[model samples]
Target: MHEWADFSVEEAGGRTTVVVTGPLLVSTIAYLDDDLRDLEGPVQFVDISAASPIDTVGAWVIYRFAAEHNAEVLGASEQAEVLLEAVEESASTADVAPRRGWFWQRVPAEVGAMVFELGRSMRRNLGFMGAIIAALLMLFRHPGRFRVRALVRQMELVGVTSLPIIGLMSFLVGIVIAQQGAIQLREFGAEIYTINLTGRISLRELGILMTAIMVAGRSGSAFAAQIGTMQLTEEIDAMRTIGVAPVEALVIPRVLAAMLMMPLLGFYAAVTAIIGGAVISQVQLGIPFLTFLSRIQEVVPVTDLWVGLVKAPVFGLIIALSGCYQGMQVRGNAEEVGLRTTRAVVQAIFMVIVLDAFFAVFFTEIGWG
Candidate 1:
């Protein structure tokens, strides 16, 4: 007989006991209630003395019945326990298989989501660009509402406030560069030309690179944190509801200001770095300040200085765009704001370095480097 084809229940003293006398497979469904309701008993006494032959499916049915009734299966036959253990192990393996597959699928889903977000970001920026053009046209027509105060204040904050730190860092960097060059040049009796090499390299590369990195860390982080805070507080939504454009109020101002200020900052870095190399030349190479300055002036052209300055707006755009994009992606939660702020700074720095490389290669190809 099938282990599950026939079953008997014994009720005594407010308890139920079940025994299997036939095949215990799909046939168990015949007796199962439609709803599988009230299938639980306080204690299930299995009459293992019968030595019923049950398969894996039969054991699964028995386990399910026992669980539904919140009952403990007593008198489990040795064969029944062995069958049930295998069934349980199979179920566990099944569970883990799906989880492993899900982990792999999750990675592709994350990539797809990022691509979707990028498309949405592009649309948002395009809309902002339209509004910017419209505003410029209006400014040309009316020639008013162009507040120079805010512009000046922004320039001062982004440019002047950042100057001292940029100056000091560039100075130290220049000294190190000069010292390194002196060592290598001295070996070839080309020590005097070290000033020219250091000056030209710093003006064309180090000054701009250092300044961009600093701004990415400072201004980009501030933009992200500020916009993220506004997002968490729903200030951005309020502006939209009140007929104010978030881009005009937040993005445009910051982008314009940072772009305007970066060139000035790059200039400051270049000048300070030149001064620094001069100091190093005096101390390390025993060259007078006048001679170092003259050599630097001869090798480093006005165009080299201009090259660093020209790259500033592109770097500033990278910083502002990365920060703004990350900030806009922030969800309305404190943890999300903090996370996006960190992402903004990191992405800005990475993009700046990447753009700097592009600039370096382009300049070299054009005979500027």
Candidate 2:
């Protein structure tokens, strides 16, 4: 018998019996552990009829002792038997090994998975582009299918309403450029050349690029979220069910609006930036407005304006397509909508920059530099 528990061993008819008593709980687990460890010799059976309120910890201790001794349990109540069975099942589960590949072997597996994912993404985007193109062709064939009212509304939403913020951003960018150019040119005794710097940079690069980026962040994300929400609510599915093409109805208006308005926005941005540059030149470089205008006329050619203008519709198309594609890709829930919206903006901006770089290289090689 142990001091902490009513445990004893008895022999009857050459069979050894171990009796357990008292509460088998967390508080007495340590005592149970010590008693269990002291138990030696072959035990045929363990009696737990006297044990009260057995728990998982005590069940585990008693079960392990019986397993090691090849002993069967005797006189256990229903609660004790349930706990012991649970412990036995848990022990069996714990014996299984966790799966983990070696580091060198995992590298190729991870790389292959990434490649497969990339391939799938490319195929999906290509299919989406084909669908959009087909929808546009169908609309062209059936001119009456065009939704003029929706297009106008989207134009107002994507273009006109975006003017103030885009104008302000471009204006501030122009001022900063003029100020920086003045400082740099003044060091070389050529402060008047700030007009040339601001005009060339704003018309050739900054104006349309910044406008595209802004639209991607603003209207592109809105398109994604709107379409994604519609998809989540099954409105998109309903449209298809009612013999309405979702791409023609939902995507075309936004795409056309972006394409039609982006060039206007870019032109507005360029003009606003030039005005801001002229203001800065007047204040900081002591150049009059007419002189600044004349300098821009002389230094910045018409081709520079054309370069920025040409990029506008392409950027708009990229933004709209990316937005609508990601929106269509949305599945399952609200969280997916938010995630895809963010991805749309990011992808649109990235593609815009990449296309801009290509244009820059092409134009420079063709003597537009």
Best by TM-score: 2
State the lDDT of candidate 2 residue by residue for 1-369, as single tens digits. 333455789899999999998888877768668878987788999999988878888888889989989999998999999999998887864436767789998999999999999999999989988988999999989999999999999999999999999999999999999999888888889887788889999998999999999999999999999999999999999999999999999999999999999999998999889989999889977889888888898999999999998999999999999999999999999999999999999999999999999999999999898
lDDT of each: 0.77, 0.92
lDDT (10s digit) by residue, model 1, range 163-236: 88999999998888888989999999998988887788788888888998898888888888888889888999
lDDT of the structure predicted as candidate 1: 0.77
Lowest-sum lDDT 10-residue window in model 1: 32-41
Clashing pairs in 1: 2-22, 2-23, 3-22, 3-23, 3-24, 4-23, 4-24, 40-69
Score every model by TM-score.
Answer: 0.69, 0.75
**Model 1: how far is 113 from its true place, Å?**
4.7
Error of 2 at 143 (Å): 0.9
Find the candidate with the highest lDDT and give its number: 2
